[model samples]
Target: MPQSSNVPNGASAAPKAKYNRPKPVVLAVIDGWGVAPHWGGNAVTLAKIPFMNKAMQEFPHTTLQASGEGVGLPPNERGNSEVGHLNIGAGQVVLQYFPSITKAIQDKTFFSNEVILQGINQAKQNGKRVHIIGLVSPGGIHSHIEHLYALLEVAKQQQFTDVCIHAITDGRDTPPFVSQEFLADVTTKTQELGVGSICTVSGRYYSMDRDHRWERVEKSYRAMVEGVGPTAATPEAAVAAAYRDGFSDEFIPPTVIQGPKNTFKPIMDGDTVIFFNFRGDRAREITQALMKPNFEGFDRKKSVSNLYFVGFTYYEEGLPIHVAFRPHNVKKSLSGVISDAGMRQLHVAESEKYAHVTYFFNGGNEQPVKGEDRIVIPSPHVPSFDQVPEMSTVQIADTVIQNINRYDFIVLNFACPDMVGHTGNLRAAIQSCEAVDANLNKIAQAVAQAGGIFAITADHGNVEQMVNPKTGEPDTEHTNNPVPFIVTGNAVVNCQLRSGGILSDVAPTLLHILNIPKPAEMTGSSLLVVQPQVARSAASTL
Candidate 1:
C-alpha cells in the first residue's frame, strides 16, 4: 500500500500565531488500552482506573479509531503495536506492509525476490532441503495462509525434492479451535503439489517470545531439535487434544508431525530455514536461535548445524544480513522531523515492546538518534506474563520521573495491560489496568511539575474488550474499539479537537502544542482548531 510521494519541509509553512505556544510534551502511550461502554466483558470499565477516568471527564479529550484504515491499514484489520506506533511516530497515514506482501505472493513476485531466490538456490546448490517456518494462520498481522500457499507453489515449481514446513499455530491472532481448518488447507495444498511436508507443529507463545524469556524459548528449541515434547498421531488429533485440555491453539504443547511412513523429520544440518513472518518482534528470538553459532539465550542441546536461515524481513536493521525482503520503510517520520528541527527526544519502554517505541515508531529505524535518549527497562523474564501482570509498570514510571527534565519530547509505553490482556486472565488484567492508572498518575504529575504538557493515548485495544459476546468467554485477541486521547496543559486551554480522529492525529496535535508547523506529507491534520461558536458565546456572557 506504500506509494511514491514527495517529502515536504515543515519549515516552509507559516505557523498559526494563535497556536504558537511551545512546551515540552510528554506523550504517554497506553498499550492495548481502549475506551468502551462499561459492560460484562469490558475489563477496562470494570477496573479501578480513577486517574484515567477523571482525566476523561475533566481534560480535553477525543476518541481515536486505532484500527483498520484509520491508521492506514487494510480495512477491518485490528491494530497491533507495530502499526499503531508506526502511524503515531510517522505523523501520517503510512501504508502497512501486510497487503504488499500479500500482493507480492499473488503476483508471483515472491519467487523472484533476490534474497528469497538466493536462499533457495544456495540450498539447492548445496544439495540440502528448504525448511519453511512461520505462524500458520490467515491473520494478516504476522503470517497468512495465502502467503504460505504461494511459497509452497513456488517450491514445487522449482522441483525441490525435500521441502519441510515447521508451523507455529495461533489462537491469539485468530479464533481458538480453528487450527484444524488451517491445517486442512495446508494438507490439501501439499497433497496437490505432490511435494513438501509438515515437519513439526507448536503453539506461537512458546516459539515467539519477544523478550528474553529463555525458559519459553528453550521449550520450543527442545521440540524442534531434540523432538522432545508431547506428540500426537496427527495435527488434527493434537489440536483436538489441546482444546480438550482447556488450551487454545497458541498455548498448545509442541507436537511433531508423523509422516505417512511414520517418520518424524527434525531439522538437521544442510537445511535452509525461511521464517515467513513479516512482523519483527515475535520473530527476532527464533531467528537469532537459528543464525547465531553460540547463542546462549537458550540451550539448543542438539546443534542445528550448517543452517541457512532467512527471515521475511530483517527484524533489526542493525543486524541486516538475514532477511529475504525489504520493509516498506516509512519516510519523513515525526521523530526524524523533530530531530531535524533541533528537539531532543527520549523513548522509554520495557524490552517486551522497546522496539515498538523506537524501531517501528521511527519508520523501522533501529539506530538511536544522535541527540535522543532511549531507555529500555527489562521486562520480567517469566514464562507467562499473567504471573506478574504488573510487569515493569512501577519501574517505568520511576524512570520517567527521574529523567523528566532531560528532553523536549518524551515518549513512554506502559506494556502491562497489553501483555497481561493477551493471557485472558480477567483478574490479572484488572490488576494491570490499576497498575497502569497509578503509574500514569505518577508520570502525569511529574510532567506537570516540570511545567510540561502531557498527552495520554493508546496504541490499540485488548483489555477493554476481554470477553466474546457470542460465547461469553474470555477473549485473548485485540478488539476494534476506539481509544481515548486526552491532553492536559496550559498550552491546550480551550483547544477544540475535531471528532473522528485516529492514531495518526496524535503527532500533528503534539506538533501544534510545540508551535511547530506540520509537514505537508502528513495527511492527518492537527485537532487544535478555532473554538466553537457556542463555547465562545458562553465565555463572552460569563
Candidate 2:
C-alpha cells in the first residue's frame, strides 16, 4: 500500500537515536539528628519537620550507628559532623586517633616506642616550629588540651625553639565561652616554663556572648539600644543598653565574619598546621575554607597552600574511624588518662569510651550535591539560647546548593536535633526537630521536581530522648539509643526492603541507587528495593 516513489529506493530505513539511561548515584550522610543514645542533639525535635517524618515512615528508612561499633570513633566519641561525613563519603571505617598516642603521652606506653611522639621530638630538634594545634578540652573527645599541654612541656624540656598552639574554639565538649579560661591556664603553664611564648589567640567560638564571659550573648541590652522588642521603649533604656550583646541580633555594633580577616590575621605559609579533633567534622570546615573554596565562604590572600599537615582534623582525608572501645567497659590499655597530662588544669575530664562520632574533613572542597542528590536537615535552624549551634547548618547547605549540578551523589545532615539535645531544653530541641522536618520537605520537593531519588538515614540517635546534666540533674551524659533512616522518590519504586542498617552502610547504598560503581572501601550496602544485576542471579541461575 506504500506509494510507489516512497517504496522504491531499496527500502529506506529510519535513523535510530542513541539512548542512554541516566547514571545512578547514591548520596548518604548522617545529619545531627542521630545523637548517641545517652548524650544530646535531636534533629527530630528542632521543628515539626514533616518531611523527615514522612521519610521515616514512608520510605526505606533505617537506623544506623554513628559511633560505637558503627562509624567507629571511641564508644564515647559521640556522633559528630566530621567523623560521620568522612565515613559516609569514603564508605569505609577506620581508626581516627588510637588511644595508643594518648597512652604513650600518659606514660602508659613510654615515649621510648611511640612513633608519633618521637617524630614530634625529632621535628623539634630540627629547630622547626614545633606547633601543636590541639583542642583545649579535658573530655578526650577531640584534641585533648592536657595532651597538648604535656606535649608542649616535653617540647620545652627538649629545648624546642618555637612552640605554638593554633587553639580553635570548642563548644560541643565544654560549656560555651570557656576558651578564655583554658587559654589562661595554658598561658600560665607556658609562662612558668617560659616555653616559646605560649600565647592564647582568641579563637572565635559559635557562642561568644562577651569577649569571654560565659553567659548568653548580651541580647537584652542590644534590644534596648536598637529599639528591639519591649526592651527599647525609651531613649534612657537605649542609652543604658550600650554594652553590646554579641549573642542576639538586636542592636550591637557591627562585626566582621570571624576569620583571618578578623582580629586574627590569616595564617602564613610553612606554619605547620596540626588538626586535633579526635572525632573530625568541625575541624574540616575551617580547614577547607582555609585551604580550598568549594563554596564562596573562603576569604584569604590566596587559597590555603604551603604547609606540612598532621591529623584527621579535616575532610580531605575522607573516611570514618572505627571506635572499637566497648561501652561501660574499661579499656585495659591506659592507666590514668587525666593524671598523665594534667587535664584538670585545662578544665577537661578525660575518658576512653563514649558514644558520639563526629565527622571531620579537609573541607577545602566539600562533597558537591547535585541532580538526583539532596541534603535533608532541619529547615530554618533556630538559634539556641545563644546564636546558632553548629556551623554545619550554614556550611553544609552552602556546599550542597553551590556545586549542586556536578555530581549525582549527595549528603543531607540536619543538625537541630543534636544541637537542642545538648541544651537539654526540651522545647527548644523539639522546635529544632520540627525545623529540620520542614527543611526535609523542601529538599524532597526539589528532588521530586528534578525527578531524582532521595533517601534519609541517620548515623546515630539523639532526639528521641533527653539526657540530664552531670552535677545538677540526671542529664549531661548520653543514653544508649536507636535512630532511623528512610528512602523515597521515583527512582526507588517497587522493591522488597528491610530496615537493618549500620552507619557504615549509609554511603554504599547511594551507589546502588545511582547504579554507579561502588567503592569497595565502604562498609554499608545498597538499600534499594531491587538488587543490581551483580546482586541478582546470573542468566544460568535465572
Candidate 3:
C-alpha cells in the first residue's frame, strides 16, 4: 500500500540523463528456457531457437542465476516459477515458503505455531478427525513430503489420534511413476510415528487445478467429502490400480482407501482440514471449494457444517482461513513502482501461467495496481502438454502484439517450454521451444517497430535438461541451471550488460532503462552498464 515515488536505494540511483529511454518496455519471460552446459537432453540447444540465439549474440545479454540462494530457496534447490517471478517482481531475493517451514520444523517452532495448534486442539476437543491434504512429492515445488511428515509428527505430539492424509500424487514436478514409492514412504513414516492414515489418493490434475476447471476440483472434493470415487483396500492398492488403468501419477483418478471394517473415511462434520501445500497458486481453487460457504464452482452433494479449515500459507488475500505460516511481505515491487510512476502496464499469459504474470510478479499481491491491464488466454484442456507443445503462445503473442503500443510497460509469459518440458519428451520439448521462439520473434518485431525496448528472460529451467545424465532416463524435473537475459532495441544499442546477475536484478534493470530510480526496498542493482556521456546524449534525444 506504500506508493511513494521517492528513490531510497543508492544501489538503484538514477543513471546519467542522456540515454534514449524507450517507452512501452516489454519484459517477455520465456518460461523454462535456460543456458545448459551441453546438448545432452538440452532442448534449448537442440531446438531451432533462431531469434533467441541471435539476440544473445547481437544484444546486451547475460546469464542469470535462477536457482538456489539467488532466488531465496534453500542451497542447491532448483528454482520454481513461484520464487522466480516473486524475485523478479520484488527486485530483491524473496525468501520462499519452503525454507521458512523447514526452519520452523528444525527449531521446534512449527510444533508450537498458534494456528496449527488451534486446528489440532479444535479437532481433539470436538472428537472429530483431522484431515491433512497436499501434493505428495519430494520435488519441493508446491508441497514436500517432509512437510507432510512434520505435520503428522505434530498430530502425534498433540495426541490427535484420528487423522487422515488426502494424498495428491504429482508427476509434473517429479517422475511420472514415483507415486507408489512416495506413498510407500508416507505409509512407513505414519506407521513409525503411530499417527495418521492415507485415506484418499488422487493426482494433481484433479486436486490442484488453478485454471478454473470446476469439474476437476469437484472430483477431488467429492472423493474426500462424499466418498464418491473408486475404492481400494489400501493406499498402495489404490495407486497400483491407477497405474494398471494406464494412468500416470498426475492423472490418477481420485480413490478412497478403505479403513477398518471395510469403511471409507470421508470428511465429515466437525472435521478440521489442514491443507499442507506451501505454495498457494494450485492450492487456491481447492481451498475455496472446501472453505467458502457460498462456493459456486460446483455443487457439493451435501455441506459439512462446523468444518474447520487451515492452510500452510495464506492462499490469497481476504480468504477466510487460518494460516500456519504467513507469507513474507514484499514491498516496492516492480509493478508497484511502475504504477506509482503513473505508467500504464499490461500483464498477459495463458491460463497455465496467468498467476505468474499477475500474482507472483506483483510480489505476492493478488489485486492489480492502477493502470494495470491483465489478459489471460485459455490454455488447452488436454491431458498432457506434450500433446500440444504450443500451449497458447500464439494467442498470447497475438494479444501482446495488438496492444504493444498502448501500455508504458508490458509483461508476458510464454508457458509452452516449461509445461511441455515436464512431460519428459525431448522431441516435444524441442517443438515447444521452437513454438515459443517463433511467436517471440513476432512480438519482438512489433516492439521494435513501436520503438520500444524488449527484454527476453526466463523464470527457471525445465526444457533445457530433459534427461538425467546419471541414469540416462527422462528427467521431468526443473534443473538448477542459469537462464539467459537478453535486452534488444535501439535504446540500449551500445550498452554493456553486467555479468553475474540473478532474477532479482531484472526489475531494477527495467527501471534503469526507463530512467526511473529504483525503490529503497529493492536491494538488486541494475544490470545495465552505464556510461554517463552516452546515456546523457541518448536522454537528450528523448
Candidate 4:
C-alpha cells in the first residue's frame, strides 16, 4: 500500500520500503535559486522533501548568506551563478575578473592592478596564450558581445599580445535560434582595429528552439539598426542596460558582418581557459560533460580535477496535490491505519475524479522577461480563466508516494515564486508560495525518516524583496523572504546549527558536513564550525 504526506503514515517504514542511507558523496552543484535558500528558491522547495527533512535532523544544521555576504558581491547584488559557485567552492572572493580588468585598462592601471587581471596579464606575459571565450549575443543574460569588444579594445590599448576571442553562439539565453550577426559585428570590429585581434565563433548547432529561428534574431537586429519599431529585442534592451550602461546606440543600419570559424578553432592546449558570462546560466550540461564526462569530444581538453562549473540566474514550481491511488481501495485501509499525527486532510475522490490525471498547458510563461522594460510590469492581473496547468503530476505523485526512498540525493527546484515576482505578480507569488508550502509539508513528512538530516537554504533572493519598478528603489517584495535550514536527524544533536548567514556558505557548509575538502578557492566558511542559534522568529515569513 502507498502512503502520502496529505495522509500520515503509521509507526514504521512501509512493508517493503528500504531506507538505505547512500554513500557520502559530495553533491556540490549550483542551482538557479536567486529567491532565497530557505523560502522561495530550490532551498525552500527542497525543505519540503521528507527524506531530506528526516535526514538533516540527525546531521548538524547552520545557515550562510550565499549571495551578498558569503559570495562578496555588492551587498545588494543579485545572485549570479559565476560568483555563487566560485565563492561556494573557491573559498575566496574573486571579483568580476573581466569587468575589473576592463576598468583597470580604462583607468591606465592595467600595468598594476588586482591580482586577477595581473594573473590574466601574467598569463600573457609568461607567453601562455590567452583564450577569451563566451556567448556571442549582446544580450546580457550571458556574456555581452560588447563586453568582448570592450575587453579587446582594452587589451589592444595595453599592448598585450596574442589574445584570441572565441564567441560561442547562443539562442537559449536570447531568442530561440539567434543569428550570428553579433559574431559578424564583433569580428568586423576586431578586424577594423587591425591590432592583431583574432576572433572565432562556435556553436553545437544552429536552429531556433522550436518554431523560432535564427532569421527572427537577424530580423530583430535589422529593425534595431534601422530605428524601426520594437520587436523581441526591445525588452531585451533593458537587460543590456542593466549590465552595461551608456550603450546608447541609435540603431545603426545592419552592418553585414562576416567571419571565419577556423581562425578561432579551440586547440586542445596552448592557452588557459577564461570563460566570461556574468549574468546568465552560462554552463549547463556542457560544463559538466566537458569537465568530468564519461565520454569524449573532438579536440576537447578534459579537466584534471580543475573542473569549474559557473553561471547566473537560477531555477521550479508545482501545483495543488491532485493524486491517484494505484491498486484502488486495497491501499485505502493501509492509508487509514498509518496516518501518524492525524494532521492532514484526505478524502477518497469520486470515482470520476479518481481517473488518471492528464497534464495540459497551465499557460505558464516559460521565459518571462521583456526586451526593454521601460515600465516594469506589475503582477496585479488575475490569471485568465483560460489559463490552466498540465495534469500529469498525479501520476508522479503516485509513483513517489509508493517508492519513497530509492535515490541517495534528490535535487528539486521550486520556481513559482521567482516566476510570480518577475511578472510583479505578488498574488501569483503568494499562490506559488502556498503551493510550494503545501508540496513541501507533504514531502518533508513523507521522506523524513526518524534519523535523516535535512538542510534548507536559498540560492538567491528574488521573491523575498521587491524592487520598485518606476523608481527602481527597494520595496518589500513578498516579505523579502528568508529561507530555513533545518535538520531533523541524530546528526543535529551534536551539530552547532544557527542563523544570520548567506548563500555561498551553503555549498561549502554542506561539503563540510559530507567531509569533503573545501577547495582552497571556495570563499565561504563552513557553518559546522559556527554555533548557529535557532531563530525564535525567522527573518521573513509567507
Strongest candidate by lDDT: 3
The CA-based lDDT of model 1 is what? 0.79
The numbered model that scores best in TM-score is 3
Q: Write the per-residue lDDT of candidate 4 for residues 64-108, one digit (tens) a residue.
A: 455443455434444443444344323344454434434544775
1 against 4, candidate with superior lDDT: 1
- Report the Cα lDDT for candidate 2: 0.41
lDDT of each prediction vs. the true structure?
A: 0.79, 0.41, 0.87, 0.35
Q: How many clashes in candidate 3?
A: 8
Worst 10 residues of 3 by lDDT: 1-10
Candidate 4 ranges beyond 4 A from true positions: 1-63, 72-75, 81-404, 467-484, 493-496, 515-523, 529-542
In terms of lDDT, the poorest run of 10 residues in model 2 is 345-354
Q: For candidate 2, lDDT tens digit of each residue in 1-542?
A: 10111222232232221221122122333344553333343324434556665565666565666665565555656554445544554455645453545655677443343433554555555444544555566545456676666655665666663655544444444544344456557667676776643322322232122111222222211211122222232222222332334421122222211222112122344444444554443344444443443424322324434444455233335422112121111111000111121111000000000012111211113321111122222233233431443323444434444433333334445554554555556666666566555555665665565556666665445555543344433132233454555666655544435565565565556545543445444445765556565234311121
TM-score of 1: 0.90
> Relative to the unseen true structure, what is the C-alpha lDDT of residue 35 in candidate 2, on a scale of 0 to 100?
34
TM-score of 2: 0.54
For each of the candidates, give the backbone clash count.
0, 97, 8, 87
List TM-scores for all candidates, in order. 0.90, 0.54, 0.94, 0.42
What does candidate 4 score on TM?
Answer: 0.42
TM-score of 3: 0.94
Model 2 ranges with Cα > 4 A deviation:
1-30, 35-47, 98-133, 139-141, 153-169, 175-198, 201-410, 413-428, 445-451, 459-482, 490-500, 527-542
